[model samples]
Target: MNRIEKRLEELKQENKKAFITYTTAGLPDLQTTAKLIFAQEEAGADILEIGVPFSDPVADGPVIQNASYQAIQKGATLTKIFDMVEGVRKEKCEVPIVFMMYYNTVYHYGLEAFVTRCIECGVDGLIIPDLPFEEQGELKAVLAKNEASPILIQLVSPVSKQRVPMLLENARGFVYCVSQMGVTGKGANFHKDIREYLAAVKKESAIPVMVGFGIRTAKDIEPFEDIVDGAIVGSNLLRILEESNYSVDAVKEYVSGFKKELNENK
Candidate 1:
């Protein structure tokens, strides 16, 4: 199993929920990106999702959009992002890392080439937001060709209830249960029936199920504690960095605080 699979399975066995963190690559420069990766790992993040900045980040809200734009402006290309991952791996950060990118980014990079690079970079999984469930066959084939290739992570939402089973048919790593129907951002209002949705997902998914999208605070995780395996915090982390003037120290402080709250659930 890849790192993501092994890590999530370990959490499940330990009766501990995952506390995942996502940040855009090359944000304020790749140096800071590398630092952020290690900081989050040091602070008890179970898994790390590194976002590859695309020209049009449709799934991202303002916080990530602005951060991505600045990243691209500072030359955050796929090659450089992969290099950052390789560097982080060399530093002995064993936490599983997943790449969150658009299908277009992977397409232009060539399917075989992309998967090969992912294996080389030590990425454990992929979350391609725009990739349709029905259209994942080609990518899946490429991934299967390599033993160490990163797994494709599936996403389920309240609106996709009817298709949850289909979307999760051959899901690897863990299932990403989108907490809301909208784009990624921080908000108190998740789906009205999020608890039910999460329950349904748990019933349908054979692998671990994690909730994301609007998850902002530690308290948000409490609601899903019984229903899901983990909570993924996104946009608000960028807000923390911005508020702290992009300090990696602040990111560690924030993740450390949230992890402390997560441990209390057990």
Candidate 2:
């Protein structure tokens, strides 16, 4: 199993929920972004989802879109993000890093080339939002050959019950279960349907299911603790990074609060 799969399995065995933290790469600056990642680890983040900014982020909301623009303005690219991961590895950090990017960036870099770079840089997995199951053949082959798992995003709507099985079929890393029907950062409450959605996904997927989008606080995640394996807080965390005065200690403390909440429930 890849690092992502192994981590999820270990979390499952330990009866704990995984804390997946998201941050835009090269936001503010590359060095600062790296510091933020390390701060996340210090705050007890189980896995790091490094956001690769793209020009047209259709899946994202205002917060992430703004983050992407800021990172792009700072010249964050696939190459720079990989270098950041390499720098982190050089520092001897073992936390699993997954590149959360749009499909266009991968296309621009070439799927095989990107996969090769990820393996070399020690990227544990990938989360490409725009790449659908039908079009993932070549990239999937490349990932399998390199032993890099691609975590598929499972967007669960009211009509998604029938589609859940197909989404779970070839998914290796944990399934990114989108919490709501809309784009990222909408901040919707977890309704009764979310429980039904989780049950449906769990019935179809053997791997762990992690919910993201609109999840802001530990309270937002409490409802999912019984059904899903983890919660991904993106916009709220990114907002913290954006508003903070570049205090790594403050960031660490903020993340530790969320981590503590997740652990306390476990």
Candidate 3:
């Protein structure tokens, strides 16, 4: 198993839910972004989702959009991001790093080249927000050939009712269960049938099912913590990054709170 599969399995075996966190790469700057990785990991983040700066982010909310814009404006190119990731790995950041980006970026970067670079930099997974379930064939084929392949995670929303099975049929890593049918950020409501949807997904999926979108606090996830394998905190974490003024200490203090809350709730 790759780092992601192994990490999620370890969590499952330990009977503990995951605490996934996200931040845009090169936000504030690449150096600060690298510092944030270990901060989140130190804060008990099980999986680290790094948002790649993109010109057009179809699935992002205002918080992430602004962060991406800032990163791009500050010259956060993919090459720089990859170089930073390699450097971070060399420094021994153990948490699994997943890149959350658009398919257009992957396409422009060239699929094989992107996968090759990901292997070189130690990326453990990918979340392509706009990649349709039907079109994962080519990407999957590319990933299967490489050693320590970076998983291509599949996403499902409450609206993806009938497609859940199809999406999970050959899915790797984990399924990113979108909490509602909307763009990502805090302050959004869970889907009306979110509980049932999650239960159904868990029943159908062989891998772990982790929820994202609109989740700001452990309280927001308390009700569904039993139903999900983990919870991803993105916009909430980004908002912290904004409030913390990119301070690693602030990120750790705020992020570490989730582990306490999640464990206390358990």
Candidate 4:
């Protein structure tokens, strides 16, 4: 199995939910980003989603947008991010790393080249928020060439309920189940029908169903219970890193608390 599948299966065997953490690569700077990546893994994060800073992050909220802007100003190129991943790998961090980026970034980098670099840098999956299922064919081709290649993760949005079966069928790695309809940030109240939506996704998904977008705290994780296999926290973690001036200690403390919250049911 690929890293993503292996990690999730391991979690399943242990009867534990995953705590996936997202942060923009080269935020503050690449050096700090490298430190944060390792720190998150050390602090109980099951997986890592390192975002490629884009010129226009349409799917991102205020916190991630600001972090992206800072990363751009600090010369956060895709090449630099790859180097950071390689650096982390050299230290023997076996945790799965996934890149959360836009389609344009992959297109600009050349799809084949991008996928090759992902394999080289030890990235296990991709989460292109804007890449529709219909258009994933090209990238999927490259991913199929290698058994351990980075898989293009599938997404299940509120409006895509009708397509859940098809989406799950085509899914690799895990299913990214969006928590709400809005951009990525702290969401106070989920839609009343969220439980039903998650239930449908769980029924159809052959792989783990991981909820993202607006998952901020332990309270946010409580409602997911058996509905989801994991949670992805992006904006709130970015906000915490910014607030802590990119302190690794701050990231570790936050992740420790978040993991505690996630495992309370276990």
Candidate 5:
């Protein structure tokens, strides 16, 4: 099994929910991004979703979009992201890294070439929010042949009842359940239906259901702890990193707060 699969299995066995964090690769700078990643791991992040800065990040909220634009301006590219991952690997970092990217980036890289490079870079999985279920067949075949799993984001809206199972079947590492309907970081409050939606997906999915998109605090995760397998914090982490004056120490501190919250709730 890949690192992602193994980690999820371990989390389940230990009865512990994963604390996943997302950051735009090369944000601020490549070195800073890498440092933030290490800090997150040390601060109790189970998996790291490294966002490859793209021009049109439709699924992202303002925080992530701004980060992507900044990273792009700083010369972040697919090659740069891969090089960053390789650099981290040279340090023997064992944390699982999932490239959270858009379909256009993969298309630009060529599907086979993209998957090949991901395997070569020690990447654990993928999260392509733009790749719809009906269109995932070719990518799924490539990933299966490579022994790499492509993670799918399960957006919870009124339409999820029809789409969740289809999304789950194609998903390998875990099912990312978006906590709200709109974009990545726009939700003001967790909807009342979130618990019911998580329960429904959990009942139908064999993989772990990881909640994301408006999750900022441990309190946000408390209500769904029993119903979901993991939590993903993105916008909040990105905001913290940006507001931290690019201090790696600040990044670590923010992640530490989340860690404390998760543990205290546990």
Candidate 6:
């Protein structure tokens, strides 16, 4: 199994939920981004979802959008991000790193080249927000060649009724279960309908299901414990990065606090 599948399985065996965290690469700079990755891993993050800077990110909210913009301004390209991943692996960090980017970036980078470099750089998974389920055929084939192949994770929303099964069928690593409609960073609480939707998704998905978008606080993870494998905190984490002025120690403290809260709730 790949690092992602293995990590998820390990969590399942321990009866503990996965804690996946997201951050934009080269937000302030690549050096800071590298430091943040290690800090998050040390702070109990099971998976690190690295957001590649893109010109247009429709799925992102203001927090991530700003991050993307800053990174892009700093010349954060796919090659540079891959260099960061290489540095991460050199430091002996085994925590799975997943790229959360748009399909346009991947396409522009060239599919085979992207997949090959991902394998080389030790990226364990990918979450292409803009890639449609129907059009994932070519990319999926490229990702399936290697034993430690980078998984292409599928996403599903509350209103994804008929398409849910299709998404689940092809899902690898885990399913990115978006909490609500519209763009991310709403930070809204889950209602009864949301709970029901998660329940249904958990029932149907064979792989791990991680709820994201609007999941800001530790309390937000409590309701999803039984229904989901875990939750992803993006906007809030980015907000913390900004608040801490990208200090590694500050980011670690925030992540540790979040982890403590999640453990306490458990």
- What Cα-based lDDT does every candidate model obtain? 0.88, 0.81, 0.89, 0.88, 0.81, 0.86
Candidate number achieving the greatest lDDT relative to the actual structure = 3
- Comparing 1 and 6 by TM-score, which wins? 1
Candidate 4 local Cα displacement, residue 95, angstroms: 1.1
Instruction: For model 2, give the 10-residue run with minimal summed lDDT.
Output: 149-158
Model 6, 79-130: lDDT tens digits are 9999999998999998999999999899989988998899889999989888
lDDT of 5: 0.81
> 1-266, model 2: which lDDT tens digit per residue?
66777877888899988889888898889999888888888778889989999998888899999999988998988898899899998998778888888888888899788878887788887787777767878777777774454444444454577778887776677888887776888886554588888878877887888888888877786765788888888888888877876679877987898878877856
Clashing pairs in 1: none
The digit string of per-residue lDDT tens for model 3 on 1-266 reads 68888888998787888888989999899999999998888888899999999988999999999999999999998889999999989999889999999998888999899999999999999999898978888988898888777989999999888999989998888899999887988475998899999999999999999999998888887777778988888998898889879888888987888877876745
Task: Superpose all Cα atoms of candidate 5 onto the true structure and report the RMSD in Å to 1 decimal.
Answer: 1.7
Looking at model 5, residue 19 earns an lDDT score of: 83
lDDT string for model 5 (199-265, tens) is 8989989888888888888778777788888788889888877787777787777777876777665
| Ranking of models by lDDT | 3, 1, 4, 6, 5, 2
Tens digits of per-residue lDDT, candidate 1, 2-35, equal 8988888888788888899999899888998898
Residue pair clashes in candidate 4: none
Question: Among all windows of ten consecutive residues in candidate 6, which has the lowest summed lDDT?
Answer: 257-266
Superposed Cα deviation of residue 178, candidate 2 (Å): 0.7
Better of 5 and 6 by TM-score: 6
Candidate 6, residue 12: lDDT: 84
Regions of candidate 3 where Cα sits further than 4 Å from its true position:
186-188
